[model samples]
Target chain A: MSDEDFQEPEVLLPLDAWHRAHGARMVPFAGYSMPIQYEGIIAEHLWTRESAGLFDVSHMGQLLVSGEGADAALEALLPGDIKGLREGRMRYSLLLSDEGGILDDLMVTRRADDFYLVVNGATKIDDIAHIHEHLPEELTLNHMDEQALLALQGPKAVDALARLVPGVEALSFMTAGAFAIAGVPAWISRSGYTGEDGFEISIPAEAAEQVATLLADQPEVKPIGLGARDSLRLEAGLPLYGHDLDPETTPISADLGFAISKRRREEGGFPGAQRILAERAAGSAFKRVGLIIEGRQPVREGAVVQPDGKITSGGFSPSLQKPIAMAYVPAVSAVPGSTIAIEQRGKIFTGTVTPMPFLPHRYHRQGSSK
Target chain B: MSLYFTKDHEWISVEGTSATVGITDYAQSQLGDVVFVEVPAAGTAVEKGKEAAVVESVKAASDVYAPVSGEVIEGNAALEADPALVNTAPEGEGWFFKLTLSNPSELDGLMDADAYKTFVDGL
Candidate 1:
C-alpha cells in the first residue's frame, strides 16, 4: 500500500454535526477531528468568562472499576487516599511509574458501588493496559466508550444548568450525583478545568446532541470549542497532560503535591512513594513556577529558560490580556518575585515568576461567599 | 499606483519606486483575531519571498513574506497600540511597512487583483 493509504483516518465525535452546524472550525487533535473554534477564540473566551459556555469534552476516557477490594487495589497504584474517599466525593490523583515518574493524572470518584475514573484522551489506551496489568484478576474494569461528556462553566453556569436539571444547584465542588436531563439519565459532577463554578455531565452518546442543544438554548450559554477551553484553563493555572505533565515529570516537581493525601504520605505504600516523600521534605531539584512575560509576544512551549529549565505550557491569557507561562526552574530561583529569562525563535524574553491562577479561581466551594 | 499580490497572500501597492505592503483580507480572516504584530524597522533590507513581518493570533503565529526585494522606510507604529487593525482593516490602515523598491520589474511577476481573487477562490 502507498504511504497515503496507510495513514489512519481521523475519528469523529458524537456531536460532530452539531459543532459544524454551529460554525466550528474542525482540526485534527489527539487522533480525532475536534472543533478548535467558533465565531473566534478571543470572543468565545471572553463570553465564557462573562456568562456561561457549553463545551463538548466527550473525547476524555471514562472507566468504571468495581469488585471486592477495588479501592485498596487502586490505592496501590495511585498516591491519593482512595479507600478514604467517601461515596459521591471526588479526588484528583496521579498514576506513577515504578521509578516515580508520572504516567498520567486523573480524577477518581467513588460511587455507591464502583469507582469512576476520568483520564486524558491521548493516554487512555496506555492507561487501560497499565491498570489491567497491575490490578488483580478479581476486579472488573469497564470502559464507558458509549458515554459522552459536556462541561458548562463560568460565573452563570449554575444558573443555566439548574434551569435544565433542577436540584443541581445544591452540588458543591468535588461532588457528583445521579441526575436526569431532558429525561435522559446522566452522571454529573460539580467540577471542571476552568477556574469557575461549573459541572461536568456524562450521558449516553446517542443523547449527546439532544443534551447539547438544550443547554445551548439557555440565554447565557454559548457553544465553545477547544481554542477557548485552552485559554480558559491556562488563565486558571491548570496544567495540561501532554504539555505540562508527562512521564518524565514527577508530581512534586509539577507542583501537584496537594493530590497526595496526608494518609498516603505517611503510609508510603504507593508507587514512587520513596522518591516523592523525600522530594516533599528536601524539595525537588526543579519546581514548576508561573511566569508573567514582560512583552506582548508570547513565549510558547519549548522555549528555553536560561541555565537549566524549559517552558512546558505558555500562552496569552485572555483575562489578564498578557502572556503567562509555566516553566520548570531551579528550586532556589523559583520564588514568586524572581526574574527569569527565556529564549524562543532566537529572541530573548524576560519573565517574572508569579503565583499561578493569574486570575483568582472562582470555584463555588461550600460556605464560600461569592 | 498598481497593486500586486503574492501566492503567500501578501499585497503590495507600488507607486513609482515606493511601495507599501500588507496581508490580504483573506489572510487576516484565516488568522482569526490578531493579538500581536512585528514588522521590520526603517533602514532594514529585505529579500524577495523572505519573511518580513509577523502576525500572531490568539491561537498561533504566521509570517508575512516580502513580495519583492527592498529597503524598509517605515513600519506601522499604530499596530503597537492596537494590533486588531490587521483584522478590522487589513488592506488599509493595517499596512505592515513602507519600502523603497530595489528592482521595480519584480512587481511584474506578481498577480493582479483579479488574478489574486481567482487564486484565493481556487484555494
Candidate 2:
C-alpha cells in the first residue's frame, strides 16, 4: 500500500473551526485534530492558574450505561464502588484488565436515570468494546458522540460560570447537575483534570460553538489549548492515560489505589480483583513517584532513572517554574525525600522524590477554606 | 561577517574562521517558548548535519543540528539561566555556541539570507 493509503485521516473536533480562527496550533492527538496551544503554552497555563481558561475537550468519550443491573455490571469491569455512588456524585475509576493491568482511567458520575462516564479519548473505543463483552446483555451502553465536552478551569472559573449558569457554584467538586447556559441544555460537573476549582460542561455538538463563544466572552475566561491543559494537569500531578497509566500498569503500581473503593476492595468482585488485592496487601514491586529535577533542563518521557526506573510523564512545570516528572521506581526509592539520578542523552541529572501535586491542588471542595 | 542558513533552521554568522550559531527567527517562532537549551562545550568537535545541541520548549525537546563541521569555542551561558532568550532575540543574543569552522568550504552548501527566507516561505 502507498504511504497515503497507510495514513489515517484525523478526526476533527466540533470546535475545529473555532480553535483555528482563534490562533490555535493544531496537532493530531488521540486521532483528532486538536489544538495544542494558542498564544503559548506557558502563558496559557499561567492564565488558567490566575483566571479562567476554557478548554475544548470534545475529543473525550462521553458514555451512558443504563439497565436493571448497570451498577453491578460496571463494578465488575471497574474497581470503584459503582453501586454505592449517589446521584450527582462522581468518582475517579480505573478499567482493569483480567491481569490487573489498567485499560484506562476514567470519571464516573451517577445521573438521575443512567450512569454518565467520561473515558480517555484514545482508549474509548476499546473501553466500549470491553464493557460490551463483559456487561450483561440486558444493559444498554450508549456512546454520546454528539455531546461536546468543555472544561472551564482555574481559580476564577466559578465566578465566570456562575454568572452564566447561576446554580453552578452550588455544585461542589466531584458533583454534577443538569443546567442551562444561555438556554442551551448542559450537564455541568464541578470537576476537571486540572487540580483547580473548575467545571466540565457537556453540551450538544451543534450548540458547542455558541456555548464556547459565550464562555470566552466572559472577562475572566480565555481559550486554552491542549498544551496548557497538559502542563496544568502535570503540575496538578494528575496522570495522563497513555503516559502515566497504560495496559502494563495497575492501579496499585500507578499509585492510584484510592480509585479502588473501600467496598470494592473488601468485596473483591471486580476484574483482576485477586491480583490487585494481593498487590494492595503485599505492595507492588514498582511504584509511581513524583520527581523534582534540580536543574533547568527538563527530563522528558523515556528518560531512564538510574538503577531501573523510567519517566512516564515528564515536563517543565509552568506553575513551579521547574522541571517535574512522574516515574516508576522501586518501592524503596519512592519516598518523598529520596534522591534519584536520571540519565538522558548520556547525561545524569539529579532529582528528589517529591510529594505531588508539584504545586498544591486548589480544588474547591465542600466545607474547605478557600 | 557573512550570514548563512541551513534547511534545519540553524543560522551561522561567519567572521573570519570564528562563527556564532543560533536557530533562525522562524525556527524560534516555530519552537514557541524555549524553557531549556543544552549547547556543546568549548573544544568539542561537531560534524555537519549532526546533533550538537538540544532546545527544549514547554512541549518537547528538539535537536539543534550543527550547520557545518566545527570546533566549538563557547556555548551561550545566557541560555543556562534564561532560555527564553531564544524566543526574544533568537538571532541577536540567543546564539547557542561559537565555533572555529574546520571546513569553510562547506559554507558553499548552505543558503544565504534571501535564499533561506524563500526556503522557509516554501515550507
Candidate 3:
C-alpha cells in the first residue's frame, strides 16, 4: 500500500578491489557492491555455458550449525529431509514459515560434526535470525562472514579446477569435501546453481584474491558478473529466492516439490506441513511454469500475463538463442501448450508455456543424469 | 544534413524534413547486446518525448523515445532478424526508423553532438 521505507547501506565484497582492477562494472545488488558485468553480460553468459565462468558470490551467508540434534532441529524449520542427508552430501531446501510461506531457499550440507548452509545473500540476515528463533539454544549457529565463496562453472569447470585442486574430479554431483586449492584449505562442493558441472569453493577471506587470480589465469576461466550468473541460473530453471520464491510463495506453488524429500512429505513434521500437503494433493491456485517467449524482447520479471499469470523470473536465454521466463499461472492455464500474451509499454508479445531448463542441464551425476 | 541528440540518448540525423532516428553509441553500450528491436510502423505518428521504439537486451527492455514529432517513414526491417546491428553501428545502418518531421522547429530543443557529449559526461 505504501513505498518501501527500508534502505540499507551497501557493503563491499571481499573481491571488490580485485573485480575493480579487472574492469568490472560494479553495481548495487542485495545490499552489497557487486559486479554486474566484466566483458559483457551476454558474452559472459555464453562463455560460462561454453567454457568456464568464475563467479564471486561471497555475499551469500555461509553458516555452521552444530549440536547433537542440529539435523532434526533444522528439519523442523524446513520441509526437507535434513536427518536423511548423508555426510558430505548437499540438499537444496527451503526455509519455510510456520504459516506455510517461504522465507528463503538454501543449500544444506551435512558435515562431520555440524551442518553447513549457504543461504541467499539478501535474506541472510533475516534467515540467520529466523533460524535462531526456531532452533534450540544449545545448538551453535556460526556465520562464516570472514570467508569467501567462488563458483567455477561450465563444461570445462572440472578440468580447470583440477589444475589447482587434484582428485576433486572424483566428487559427484550434490557432493562436498575438504580440499586444498592453491595451498589454502577450502571446502569444495560439486554442486552449483548454474545446473552446469562445476564446483563451489569456500576459502578464507584473506586468501580470496590470490585464489581468484589463480583460477582466472586459467584459459578456461573468466570472471563472470551477477548478470551472467543470473542468466545462467534462469537457464538452469533455478528459482531465485527473492524473485521466484517469496514470503507468499509456498514450495508447491513455486513448483519446488523436489525440495520436499519423500520422508518429510509423508511424516509431515516440518513447518506449514498441513497446508503444503493439502496443496500438493489438490493443486495450488497458481502453479509455476516455464515459458519460451516468441519474440526477442525479454518478458522481464514483474510482467503480468494474460489468462491470469504473474511472471516471477524472466530473461533472454543465451543458450537457446531465445527469450525465456518463469511465471505463476492459474491452475487452468498452467498447461504446457497454453499460449499467453504479455503487454509491456503498449506492445504485446506472445509466449508459449514450455518445460523449463530452456537449455538442457549438464550436471554430471553419479553414472547418469537424474 | 545535421545530427541531433536527446537527453534520453536517442539520436536523429536530419536531411530536410525527413530524419533518420536511432540510439547513440553511448546508449547501445549502456543497454548491452540488444536482442530485439520494435520500431513504429510506417504512417504511424509519434510525438516528441513519446515512446517510438523498443529495444531489449538480455537483462531488460528499454523504450526509445522520439526526439521530435514526426510520422514514421519506414521501420528497419533488418533489425527484426538481427538486432545486434544496433550495437555494432548504432549511428548508421542500425537506425530504427525514418520519420517525416511534422515540426522542424522541435529540433531546436535537442542537443548537438558536443553538448550531448558534455551532458553524458556529467551523468
* Best model number under DockQ: 2
List model 2 lDDT by residue over B55-111, tens digit each.
Answer: 999988999989999999999999999999999999999999999999999999999
Residue A113 lDDT, candidate 3, scale 0-100: 93
For candidate 2, the lDDT comes to 0.92
The regions of model 1 sitting more than 4 angstroms off are A1-9
Give each model's whole-structure lDDT.
0.91, 0.92, 0.90
Residue clash pairs of candidate 1 = none
Least accurate stretch of 10 residues (summed lDDT) in model 1 chain A? A1-10
Q: Every prediction's TM-score for the first chain?
A: 0.97, 0.97, 0.96
Candidate 2 local Cα displacement, residue A205, angstroms: 0.7
Q: What tens-digit string does per-residue lDDT give for candidate 1 at B1-123? A: 999999888999999999999999988877888888999999999999988998878877778888999999999999988999999999999999999999998998999999999998986
Query: Candidate 2, residues A232-343: lDDT per residue as tens digits?
Result: 9988899999999998999999999999999999899888999999999999989999999998889999999899889998889988899999999999899999999999
Interface RMSD of each: 7.9, 6.9, 6.7
In model 2, the clashing pairs are none
Model 1, residue B79: what's the lDDT? Answer: 93
Can you give the lDDT of residue A254 in candidate 2? 98
Q: Compared with the true structure, what per-residue lDDT tens digits does model 1 show for residues A1-370?
A: 0001123336898999999999997877777778889888888999999999999999899999999999999998899999999999999999999878889999999999999999998899999999999999999999999999999999999999999899998999999999999999999999999898899999999999999999999999999989889989988889999989898889999999998999999998999999999999999999989999997888888999998899998878888888888999999989999999999888899999999888888888988764
DockQ of predicted model 3 = 0.45
Query: Quick one: ranking by DockQ, best first?
Result: 2, 3, 1
